[model samples]
Target: MPLQVAPTFRDALAAARRPLVGMWVCSGSPLVAEICAGSGLDWLLIDAEHSPNGPESLLAQLQAVHGYPVTPMVRPPVGDPVVIKQYLDLGAQNLLIPMVDTAERAAAMVRAVAYPPHGVRGVGSALARASRWNRVPDYLRTARTTLSLYLQIESAEAVENVEAIVSTPGVDGVFVGPADLAASMGVLGEQDHPEVVAAVEHCLRAAKAAGVKAGLNAFAPALARRYLTAGADFVLVGADVQLLARGSERLAAEFIEEVR
Candidate 1:
């Protein structure tokens, strides 16, 4: 099977007038990644920040998504240079860095994700497992251009600095992490909090002004729609575990009611 490059996701988002649906797969299971990839999702995000997945697990998940229609993305714990470089080297086409609060942080993330001159990402095996062990010789040439870097705007500070953050070079897009943003504003679990909503709107406006894409993490279709209508370029839906739990609970409840 021909290995799909990172451009697929970038192009998909670029071409979409409306928001694209992305499912979060944090289980670190290759099987689950494959399933999600074939499930008509526009993209799959492997959560390394909140999930228990280490480097190896992340790599496996990325590999599993290969050849499928969904583009694979990794959400690293933070925007640390080493962590960013590690996942990029492992072949993650897109990276979602969490808790980006300032333009400086966004710029640092860009530097971490890019190579020399542009940034300080240590290069090793260009033909390593990330490139299918020499299968793609031109990997380095296209790597910088093909890579997608989404900075998570999830705090009051981030919202305030939204304009500067989006304007930073190499920052492909901005994703709103509503839960965290709400919490940071002292309103935990209130996704609909006035402050959170305002912040999201600010991010959208900033992204649009900067001519860059914007994204959001939403669990429900309704929530996703809200973001889309607000001009989000990409929308991430529920996680694999959450989907499974919800489905299982509903099925069990239905069966119990039928028996009664």
Candidate 2:
């Protein structure tokens, strides 16, 4: 019998018919990854960019969450072709590539995730888990069709070129990074600043207008809801580190105040 590949978070995002909520996992721990995977999230971002997760750590985390229903989306430190190749080979079907500034870059990323005659992703031998160690037959041939590529629109320049970037063929979606976008617009941490909000909203609208999926990393519930209402296909509501820090701080603060 042949392998049966299930629908991915990317497939849902590409459909763009509803809102898919997700979270960021920066802890790089399989324990933490498994815990979050049980939280009923639609997807999870295994952040190798800001997190300490190298390829090995990412592989472990992906394995930890393999039994869950949630899809694991990995973000490389940078959107380099070689880096993406390794992640794809490790069984990551959904990707959030960072710092994409042009349609050319987005197109390149699309090719990076595809096999020959479609893109330049290097073919690996039977050593990759992506093929289930030879379990997933013809993985090289079918990978291009199942792989979902979401480019990160994190800069003023990227936001300016949002429409063009969304128009790139094989680019499944675009994720707006408000933090970097704010910094780019001269508002270091003011993601809620009217200017930054406008830019993010513009990108969201642009993607939707182009009939492509739009998503964002909005940590605040109200903010995330606002974007979803404005037609975002998916939104990453929070990060593991933020939840741990805030929850721990709240727990400790209550005790400290009671002792005082």
Candidate 3:
């Protein structure tokens, strides 16, 4: 199948009759991006907030993923409109905004992703990679449909306002940040803490009730399966950096053992 011009993450979810598996690409390397694209994964998240990916690096990564089957989604540090616009203009079909704590904040995120009337995303030159560098003049007409917006409910405040946040217009989905959420819940370093688990389940229930997709970041296959069975639509398995670190460590350990 030809690579889609502007495929939304939600579109991918809708297409996923079964559970979907995604991997986080925090390393911003072209080779890594290419590998993930060619892998059988449904989508790849280009993490900018926690990664060392400046715009240049992100451009290269996006280029590397081009022509592959997996869609590219970006998670900006915060849901700043300028940052969101820049990434969207750079060809990110989907956006995952972090630390959404209220319905108003969720609305702001939606506005940043949308055009006028629906939201306040400023429109200008579609002469960017997102529009195939001026290849598509009807970009604005189909932009909304092409873009997906996900709000991260990763804080105590967010869990409290989960219902309102998920009900906001243009909010496509919710992603749980277990680490941050655990900290926010005053149970730091305990992802499986009862309070944290309750918060996550609450968020899931809210998403289901509102008829929106729910997502979770699962670092292990077992955890990924658990989330899927618990009603998560999308599950992020691992990150490029973490995978590399683990592989290198294991290889070095094996070599040392052999030498000994």
Candidate 4:
């Protein structure tokens, strides 16, 4: 069978008529990932940053969602080049790098994913699923086009450098993280704080002005809408674990009261 490169998150955004709505698959379970993949959302973020996912589990989840229509993006725990290379070799075409607080860091991430001369991604296509075990023609040369890289602006420093960060070459997009931005602003757990909102908006504007895609992780309907209205090109509006948590709670609330 001929191997085909999938559409990247960048391509999806450029082609999308509206903001691409997505959710987080944080449970580290392939079953949960499969369920979320079929939910008709435009994308799904398979989180390894805050979830219990290891390389094996991440690979399983990625494989599980391969047949679905949703675009699966991965969030590695850190922006280390070694880690990025690992995830890339594991077949994560879309990546959301957390805690990128400066343009230098953003540039480093670019080099981390690119092949040497352009950058320094290690050569191991034959052993990598990303190349379909050497079946993908010109895999090394065309890998960049098939990939999308979004850096997370989760701290005060990142917001302060928002313009430069968005303007960095090879950074496909920036995904503003209000939750951590709130923490960095000393308003821990208050994602909707006015100050955090302002910071988030600052990033949105910078990305849009630079012609780079901007995204947000907003679970609340109102907040997600607000970010979208603020010019977010894509938004993660829900999560698999949260739905189960809230749904099961609601069911228990009704049944426990009647059963006891």
* Predicted model with the maximum lDDT: 4
Cα error, candidate 1, residue 217 (Å): 1.1
> Which TM-score value belongs to model 4?
0.98
TM-score, one value per model: 0.93, 0.96, 0.95, 0.98
lDDT of 2 by residue, 1-260 (tens): 45645567767665645698989999999999999999998899999999999989999999999879888899999989999999988888888999999999999998899888988999883788787776777877787766788999999999989999999999888999999999999999998999998999999899988998888999878888888888888899989999999999999999999999
Clashes per candidate (backbone, < 3 Å): 0, 0, 0, 0
lDDT of 1 at 229: 86
**How high is the lDDT of residue 187 in model 3?**
85
User: In candidate 4, what are the lDDT values of residues 138-184, reduced to their tens digit?
Assistant: 89899898899999999999999999999999999999999889999
Q: Per-residue lDDT of 1-260 in model 3, one digit per residue for the tens?
A: 22237567788889879877889999878898899889899889999889888778888998898889888888998789998888888878888998999999999998898888877777863467777755665777777887899999899999999999999988999999999998987888888787887788888889999999999887867666767788998888888888899999999999999999
lDDT string, candidate 1, 113-172, tens digits: 777888888876444566666466576666687688888999998888899999998888
TM-score winner: 4
Q: Comparing 1 and 3 by TM-score, which wins?
A: 3
Of the candidates numbered 1 and 2, which has the greater lDDT value?
2
Q: Tell me which residue pairs clash in candidate 4.
A: none
Give the distance in Å from residue 226's predicted Cα in candidate 3 to where it truly belongs.
1.9
Off by over 4 Å in 3: 1-4
For candidate 2, the lDDT comes to 0.89
